[model samples]
Target: MSLTVRILIGLALGLASGIALAEWGAAWEADAVAIAQPVGKAWLGGLQMPLIPLIFALLVTGITQAAATARGNRIAGRAIALFAMLLLAAASAAALAGPLL
Candidate 1:
């Protein structure tokens, strides 16, 4: 079988196992403290293992490109301002609708 098929099968098996465990009692149920805690910690550790090098590489490449551009500062400033304005607008809308819900 293909790699995609194998990955899908693994995902399906994982989902089925999770559902079965959830249906059992607390002792059998895969709660955060029981099953997920260690798994989550290990997964996070694996993800963070190469994060520093990846971040440094990305930052160096970004800075080099930005320095090479004539209008990079202006573009970055406008992007930041637009993002802030959109974020504020979203927060204001959510606040206004919170009471109605």
Candidate 2:
């Protein structure tokens, strides 16, 4: 089978098994947790390993592009300023609301 089909089947089986365990395998909960915890951590660590460098690279690229554009024209500078203001406002809102959440 193709990789896409294999991935889909794996996802379906995982969801099904989790639901089954939740509904009818209460006694196995601790065992499942014991087995899954390390696997979950490893999975997340693997996923995150490449993302830090990728995000930093993208951020650097975006900043350089934005700076170049901003230097070239008044309209671009204003647009970049507006974008920065909006970004700051959104971040501030999230920070203010995060504690309540």
Candidate 3:
């Protein structure tokens, strides 16, 4: 199946199993945590280890291209302006709603 569907299925199964274990598997909880903790940490570390350098590379590449385009292209500049405004608006909305959440 597609990656998206596989991810959704995994998410649903995880949620269901978590709830089942929480409700009826108290005896297995300690063993489950012991098994899951190291695995989860390793998974998270695998995901995170390359993120900083990847993000820095992407940002450098994106800014270089954007600056070059925005310098001579009015349309690109205007589009970038609109993008920035929307980004700021989204951030502001998130900040305002964060406390309520």
Candidate 4:
């Protein structure tokens, strides 16, 4: 199956399991949380591990290319403008989703 389908399946199973454990296994709640905490943290940490270096590399590459290209200054300005607009759009999406979520 596709990655998206797998993710959806995993999400559904996770929710079902969580709900079952939370509602029917109250006594195990604390232990369950404790046991799961490290896994959650590791998942988050793993996701963050490569982001900084990847972002830095992208920034450096963009800078070098912008400097080397014809009409370099204008291109850099346009790139920054586009990047800002993208960031704004992403922020808007998160903002819009936050309240609904």
Best by lDDT: 4
Winner on lDDT between 1 and 3 is: 3
Q: How well does each candidate superpose onto the true structure, as a TM-score? A: 0.49, 0.54, 0.51, 0.57
TM match of model 4 to true structure: 0.57
Q: Candidate 4, residue 26: CA error in Å?
A: 3.2
**Per-residue C-alpha lDDT of model 4 across residues 3-94, encoded as one tens digit per residue:** 99999999999999888887788876898789989999889879966765576558657866767776587777677667667756766787
Q: Candidate 2 vs candidate 4: which has greater lDDT?
A: 4
Candidate ordering by lDDT (highest first) = 4, 3, 2, 1
Q: Which clashing pairs does model 1 show?
A: none
Q: What would the C-alpha RMSD of candidate 4 be, to one decimal place?
A: 7.6
Q: Tens digit of lDDT per residue, candidate 3, span 1-101? A: 99999999999999998998888889869998999899998898799667655654565567658878667456555655665676567667876996698
Candidate 2 per-residue C-alpha lDDT over 1-101 given as tens digits, one digit per residue, 9 for 90 to 100 = 99999999999999998898888879769987999899998898799667545654565567668778766556555655665676567667876996698
Choose 2 or 4, whichever is better by TM-score: 4
Name the runs in model 4 displaced over 4 angstroms. 1-7, 71-101
The regions of model 3 sitting more than 4 angstroms off are 1-10, 66-101
Backbone clash pairs for candidate 3 read none
lDDT (Cα, 0-100) at 6 in candidate 1: 100
Model 3 Cα shift for residue 49 (angstroms):
1.2
User: What number of clashing residue pairs does each candidate have, in the order they appear?
Assistant: 0, 0, 0, 0
Question: Candidate 2 vs candidate 3: which has greater lDDT?
Answer: 3
The positional error of residue 17 in candidate 2, measured at the CA in angstroms, is 0.5
Best by TM-score: 4
Name the weakest run of 10 consecutive residues (lDDT summed) in model 2. Answer: 51-60
Once model 1 is optimally superposed onto the true structure by TM-score, how far is the C-alpha of residue 50 displaced, in angstroms?
2.9
